[model samples]
Target: MAEDLAREEPRFPPAEADVLVPLVPARREGGAHRVRFGLAYLALAAVAGAALGTTVVVLDRPGKTAGPEWSSWQPSGDRDAHPRQIADHVSQRYRRPSGTQLVAVTYAGEPQVQQVPLSAVAIQTGGDGSDSPPKFVQIENGLMYNLCGLGPSCAFPEGELSEGGLQLLRREALELALYSFKYAGADSVIALLPPNVGNQQDPDDDTSRTLFFQKRDLARELERPLRTTLLAPEQPQPAEIDPDEGLIIDRLTQPRLFQYEIRQAQEGSAFLILAPLVGG
Candidate 1:
């Protein structure tokens, strides 16, 4: 009975082959989903590269630098930073030692005068001398009176300065004026030469020679350092004068000396009266 039962159970053929069924569908390599993912990856990479490039460019760009501090003289406060103080500083710094005379070449057919250190510096602040700093912007349209002479009388001997000597004197005056304009923040500077005093009692009897400088007139020269500008070449002689040398001649060599006066008005306001001397 056991042998008959076993033969009956083994009658089915090797039980059907095992079959496997996947849970999800298979995808192709070049399918739309794969292409979309590749494009998104490339776009992200491109955006990252662009951002990095922009950062590098911004880091490499140059930036503006601050201007130089030209003078060692610093004011105690803004209230003390006035043209008069600047002038005083300049006069003290540039005062010539006793018994030293400035020498220069003599030119024919030119007036002669002696060159000396600055004696005093006066400021016309377009005010009644009460304001600490003038109410108006004097740097734009102000007058700096630089007095040059030997004594309180501020008189110079006649025929002591040749044309070249005068030119040298003018150079000195210009240097002072430049320093005043730079440190004092003035736009205009007038350097007054000592008057040819016939009488020692009255020094103002004669018209004093003058040299005027304006900031706008010296735009090119001001771009350089004060030392380089001061070391400019000597003035050319009349024979060596160039037509294009108008700046050098008008500013340094043959500056027309004008006589100026501060006339007080009836209302207490003062006005500057400028007139060209007869032979300026």
Candidate 2:
């Protein structure tokens, strides 16, 4: 039986030879194509990642973008100069329309005399002494009897001034504060206008009407031509004033006044005492 089976030809169902295809050849071809596609995808991803990394590096660089408008006024002269020196520079350069110099009072109560009686006190904040860079600058100026029309010879009565006159006085004080902010790198400015004539006589007098200004608030004006911003109107009228300008004027004209005292606990240890003036 073994010999008969070996000699007999295998009889099975007949099929077309063309229809019998090997799976290995098809699989090998598909796998090769998939590997090529994967390599191309990885190459593209690498390029995209490089581009994004470059963008981030460019953006991270300093001064690549513009700063705020108010920051355009860069500090000039000796970069390492003391704050007091900077204050002195600002005072010397400042000029009024009448071509008169502004009086500058230092922290130690020493006065730098000028042609005009108008005074400016630059108070440095957040520092051990005048040598350090100030965090903020407080500029105090007086509205003298002559300026306020309060003297016997003036048209206005004592302690009285027209709305226009008051606004003019505030504008002068604000301009000085702006100069300090621009030249001294002050972040904020406190423009203190003490009661008309009394505080002028006494340097330590606490009675004051204050107008606060942040660098951001006057950014637009500072960006414009300095002459235009400082231009004195022939006759300033309330009706013709811009709304933004009006807001600042309104704040200056507020009834309330701020009072503060300077007390020195010991030599080289000075402090301030602040409170709202009652019925001011």
Listed per candidate, the RMSD to the true structure in angstroms reads 20.5, 18.8
lDDT of each: 0.48, 0.43
Best candidate according to lDDT: 1
Q: lDDT tens string, model 2, 1-280? A: 3342233222335666778655666777778988997997787777767766766666665875854454323446763343345345434443334444322323222111223221233334323334644232232431211122223432233423334444545554555456655665555444444345233334343344554455666676667654456443332442344555656554543322334344443443333333333222
Q: Name every residue pair that clashes in candidate 2.
A: none
Highest TM-score: which candidate?
1
Report the poorest 10 consecutive residues by lDDT, candidate 1.
104-113
Q: TM-score for model 2?
A: 0.35
- Residue 239 of model 1 has an lDDT of 35
Off by over 4 Å in 1: 1-43, 64-141, 156-162, 179-187, 197-206, 212-256, 260-264, 270-273, 278-280
